[model samples]
Target: MQLDSGAVAEGRVTRVTDFGAFIQFDNGETGLVHISQIAHSFVRNIHDHVHEGDTVDVKVLGRDERGRLDLSIKELLEEPEEIPRPRAIGRQSPQFEAKLRSFMRDAKERTTAGGKKPTTPTKRKK
Candidate 1:
């Protein structure tokens, strides 16, 4: 199978690296899907989503002059069905609960170790 510049293809994950995964295209061509290109959302760990020997559908976005195939798995996903629009709501983005808990624990530790309020200044009597 001849691989074209903009053809979608399914490939097997041959190797996984810290920065990207090497996909072996059925045509015998291989390409790297950078960690950033793995998902539309933040990817803290690649292993959470993909593993070696797993076959995944990928879209060939384009290729650089160097002939590297740029692929996007997220783009190949079927569009999620749209639901009825909800009324406008005032809310902040959900916090990273794990990170928030860590910060709170650190703050408590600092307060206990220092034994003083951060906002109160120590005063010296004249």
Candidate 2:
């Protein structure tokens, strides 16, 4: 299959590394869901959300110069803002679990916790 940017597909994780997981699509194309792209929140451990041989749906984010496909599990997930929940002033509600989960997941992505550094702003080209 010709994987394009923004294309979404289902695949089984073929391998896992400190940096990411390799997903093999039914189409025989394998893509890497980088640790950074694994979730919307910080990701401390990739295994927490995905494991080898696990089937998962992912969104195609882009392709690296080497032709490796960059995938995202979070993109396939519903945005926190879109979910309905109860609001509590200066407090967290059990209903906020969905958003909380996302935050915790992304929290693991912190470099201090062994994940990649957050995206840095790039200088505009002249």
Candidate 3:
């Protein structure tokens, strides 16, 4: 079977390495799925994701200069939804902005007063 770029196929993992996994298709064609292509998220260990003899579906990313097939399992898997990030301090809510402004005003007032920080009143010995 001619495997073209973007083609999807089922293959059995022939070997697993620290960098990637080698898969052999039914047609006897072998491909390497790089660690980065094994999952959508960070893969600290390739063995944690795939092992020898495991059947996985992969997409043909294309061929290397040496005619080695470059495959990707993540391309065949569903992409994870992006998690929303908290707004930056500059883009904080109106309430937060008000609080910040009040604090800044207070600090500016203290600095301008005498460059001295406020001291708590201490009790004198009786």
| Candidate maximizing TM-score | 3
Estimate every model's Cα lDDT from 0 to 1. 0.79, 0.84, 0.91
* TM per prediction: 0.58, 0.60, 0.64
lDDT of 1 by residue, 52-71 (tens): 99999887777778898777
Root-mean-square deviation of candidate 2: 17.6
Predicted structure 2: lDDT: 0.84
Provide C-alpha RMSD values for all models, in order.
9.7, 17.6, 10.9
Error of 3 at 17 (Å): 0.3
Ranking by TM-score: 3, 2, 1
lDDT of 3 by residue, 1-126 (tens): 789999999999999999999999999989999998998888889989999999998999999999999999999888889733545556789998899999999989987677777777999999
The count of residue-pair clashes in candidate 3 stands at 0
Runs of candidate 2 exceeding 4 Å displacement: 82-126
